[model samples]
Target: MKLRKINKQVWLTEVELDGYNVRGAVICGDKKVVVLDTLSHPRDMETLSTLIQGRALIIVYTHADWDHIWGTGGLIWEDARIIAHTACLERFNTDVPVTLHEKQLVEPARWNGVQLVPPNETFQDEFCLDLGSLTLRFYHLPGHTQDSIVVFLEQYGILFMGDTVETPFPCLEKQSPLFRWITRLQRWESDPGVKTVIPAHGDMGGRKIIQRNIAYLQDLSAGKDPGVFEPMTQFYRETHGANLGFALNASKSDAFKLDASKKNNP
Candidate 1:
């Protein structure tokens, strides 16, 4: 794990686990230390605990994906409140075990100490945490997953977009509403307070990253191939294809419903 300071109060920790480069953030506020998505393993979070010692701790899970939440078990602060979207709690309870089982099969030793920990506090739509020096705002952005959220540090204008936006291309949930994702992107674009955007799996950038994701989603909706805009890694190529497939399938489903409606009305 490598820790890089984003600012005096904020830090980014990068970890390579199971072939994926995942990042989590730490925001040291006046009254509380906020730990963003925990990395893949319990051992990864041990150093994090040491760094934020002696302050009130709040663990925020951006989503319930195994990579982000697995380290919840490893946190040293037992009394810390775990926060997430209500949908994230549902996903953690229903889908996380299957994901854990599949990943453990690949590397049992690394996951040996992992314990499933669900959020103790849950909310829908939006929530805010006043950390004395800065406020952390959680916005539910559901395109990546039903429970995916983006964290905005109001004072610093930094946004931690958990897999909601990515470099090259953004992945889509099978049932994600493209329009809703586009609307969120548009809102971000117009928000003058946003200075930086941090994605879970890609390099951090400014508002341009939000524009790029919006363009990709718009292209997918328009039936225009988005591969021409950027070169994708093998993994991202597969991801883009799957996203495109989901969009096409959704379009067809909508068309079919329209046709059925017309026939019934006539």
Candidate 2:
């Protein structure tokens, strides 16, 4: 419903994806176009692709998260090369047994009939795509997920951090190296060129979002009160209807009260 042009090459559109308001980006280059993430359902991307007909569009998945990459089969562009972190491809191949069952329950009606597609191309640390005048830098940031990565447009200073620090609910249960994740975020926070931050889940902001996420995790690491952690879980569940404690050994709490027991390992 809302659209914001970040730069000459970047356009942010807040679209209704699978009944949830999710953000997607279109990064324009002289010779090609780059799409940040996909929608929750196939029809959503089908609709998005129609709007972007007759353009050189390449799709990149920031991570292998269901919300961002589940609709890959919808956007049918022969020229659009799908790219993601190497680990993400592995994650995509091996579906978590529990999440497979959970996804069956919450996935949108449109996604019910579509076949899923995994990324064809994968990389480890760094990959550069030169779209004539614009250059995209994909860096591996293993925090939210060991497969999690951020897309940095060096020419524009835009960093598309996929689920790294968008929502209050942290999805580190699937993450392999937690400490490295923390370190990656801290280093990004101090990067002077990273002026714009685009998250796969929430509103796009500046470097402040990175700092806020770091603070929340640091508190959690220190064993802070459960009261402070309640909001994050509730916010994610309320928005996505996802159970935050799916695979993790964490407690669940209701948002109705600020009780002492309303905390979980978000």
The numbered model that scores best in TM-score is 1
Compared with the true structure, all predictions reach lDDT values of 0.83, 0.66
Worst 10 residues of 1 by lDDT: 257-266
- Model 2's number of clashes is 0
Candidate 1 segments whose C-alpha is farther than 4 A from its true place: 228-231, 254-266
Tens digit of per-residue lDDT, candidate 2, span 58-168: 888888767676555677655578888888778755862245446677864534655556677889988998888888888888767768888888677788888777655
Write model 1 residue lDDT over 1-266, tens digit each, in one string: 79999899999978885445888999998778988988787777888766687888899999988888888777765889889999989986688988999878997986778998888899999999999879899998877788989999978999999888888678886676676767777888889999999998977899999999989988877777776445556777678778888887866777434533443232
Winner by lDDT: 1
Task: Mark the 10 consecutive residues where model 2 has the least summed lDDT.
Answer: 251-260
TM-score per candidate, chains pooled: 0.92, 0.77
In angstroms, the error of model 1 at 170 is 0.9
Clashing pairs in 1: none
Candidate 2 ranges with C-alpha deviation above 4 Å: 1-3, 16-20, 96-109, 174-176, 226-233, 237-266
